[model samples]
Target: MLTAAAHLGACAGGDPGVGSTNPFESQGNSNSMSGTTQPGSDTDSTPTVGGSMTDSDTSTPTGPGPGSDSDPTGSDPTGGPTTAGTTTLPDPDCVDDDGDLHGEGCNAGPDCDDTSFNSWQSCGTCVDQDGDGFWVGCDQYGPDEPGPDCDDANPDASDGSDCECAVTPDAKASDTCAEGMAGALGVIAEGGVVPPIKGSITGIDNGPGNGQEDWYWVEFPEAMAMGNRPNAGKIAATFAVNPGDPTSPDYRFEVYTACNKPAFEGLAATYGPGTPPAREWEFFDAHSPPNPNPNPNPNYLNNVPWPAKVFIRVIRVANDQSCSEYTLQVSRLPT
Candidate 1:
């Protein structure tokens, strides 16, 4: 009876396989056995599997598991709660201030002209606040179409019109001689009109009866001396008081060959009171003989060489306190 019982125990302890009864021999196996198990029984306690282990007492884990810190989802790798939802974006049309097909303000788009809905689309019709019939935004307009008014404030200064202020003439003494010589008043050309010069006599005189004097210069270019022979040797400058006052003090006119300032002592010729109201001062080379010719052919040519530059002085004789208006005429006598 003892032998039969021993044989029965041996049969009950079925053949021990090649390795232990751990069913999950390879790590690649999905179902692994880890908990305690009956020595020969086929059943195993809840498998503490290679992956996450499920607690028999509770459905969820009390604390974070192995890879809880590394996993971005913050849940057990095997099986745990997860989040699933959708994110809504901003509306496309709400922020588009300018409908120029471009958005403004943030990442929407680059639309500089946000004020007008489609100003960029129709740039030809830009704003014209002054209403001078010209658009103020763009400079590239047709010649006939006025645009880019220089002075938007003044309507009179619109496109195609003068935008700058008129320049006024200011004549001051020493204005000419400051450059080493008086400025050339004008050239001696036949039929040329010498503009009248107006200036004050106040404070210009050295004394009560010394008379006030003004200086001027004139140039005779070689071109003017080329043609007429008789006139080539004679350059005459005439002076007259416009609206001459009979009671007005006599005015003297003198011509000089040099431009020496302060003392125009060159004194090539002189004409004044006792002479006709309209006097013609002549200039000739210094080496030439005194002019023996009469009226129309007065002694005007200078002793200086051709293409000469002569200096002139106008003096208001003593007692002439009134401002004077004078007209000067320069001409090359006809042959």
Candidate 2:
């Protein structure tokens, strides 16, 4: 009996039971039997394994895990994974400070003269204030007939009329009187005595036998006298005949110190006789009156008193000739 008891102890220690508390224990032999007499009996002599199993699998699943669908800190359940914060952008084509639809310079808009709201996209057409069919500073694009308006501010001074002296009638040759004169005529009483008076000689016809003549009266005041005596007065004059018309008339010029208004017939001190007329003529107070010869000696200086009043006469030497036009420039020389 002791030997049999020893054998049972060895078998129990070597073989593990099917329902044992430790899973690592060895299994017992199938032939060996203990007590359990009936199946599904509450009082059966057998160990019942009832505790929970220890889980060793620690790998997270690809679908969902902590901080995933179940966790609030993970991705949103309604959507997919959470995204980073977003930012808004501005329009690329908008420009200009006035808020107008146009802009200028480097911007991507069409505003010329962006400073002025009224001039947006208006550079293609210019502004004409005077309404002479030509815009100010834009005359080069118009017809040459009326060229460019010299003064757009004044309508009277346009390209169609001679806008000289700011008057209309002063451009004609027949209008030589003071009322029609546009500029200074060297009259001493009319303020400062500015020299170099310019005038035109036109519409003057030669008489039936000789030719027609025009007279200009110049009064020099004693206070405004330029030179001292006889040598003090010097007249340098130039006459340029306008191109066209019958052969340029044989023109002559004469300066008289006396106030003689004799008929336009024979006048003394006349200088002419050259073909096509002399383009330039000069008179010196040092020489004798009535055809005063130009002073030949440069060193010689005359002290003769200059006449207070003088008459400048321009005449055509030929007869039966039509009217001729010429420009006369008279200037005073230094004494």
Each model's TM-score? 0.33, 0.29
Instruction: Give residue 199's error in model 1 in angstroms.
Output: 3.3
- Backbone clash total for model 1 is 11
- In model 2, where do residues sit more than 4 Å from their true spots? 1-184, 188-211, 225-227, 230-233, 240-250, 259-281, 285-305, 318-324
Rate residue 153 of model 2 by lDDT: 42
* lDDT leader: 1
Among all windows of 10 consecutive residues in model 2, the one with the lowest summed lDDT is 1-10
How would you encode candidate 2's per-residue C-alpha lDDT over 156-188 as one tens digit per residue? 556534344321123322222232232334554
Worst 10 residues of 1 by lDDT: 4-13
Instruction: Indicate the TM-score of model 1.
Output: 0.33
C-alpha lDDT (0 to 100) for residue 49 of candidate 2: 17
The CA lDDT at 114 in model 2 is 53
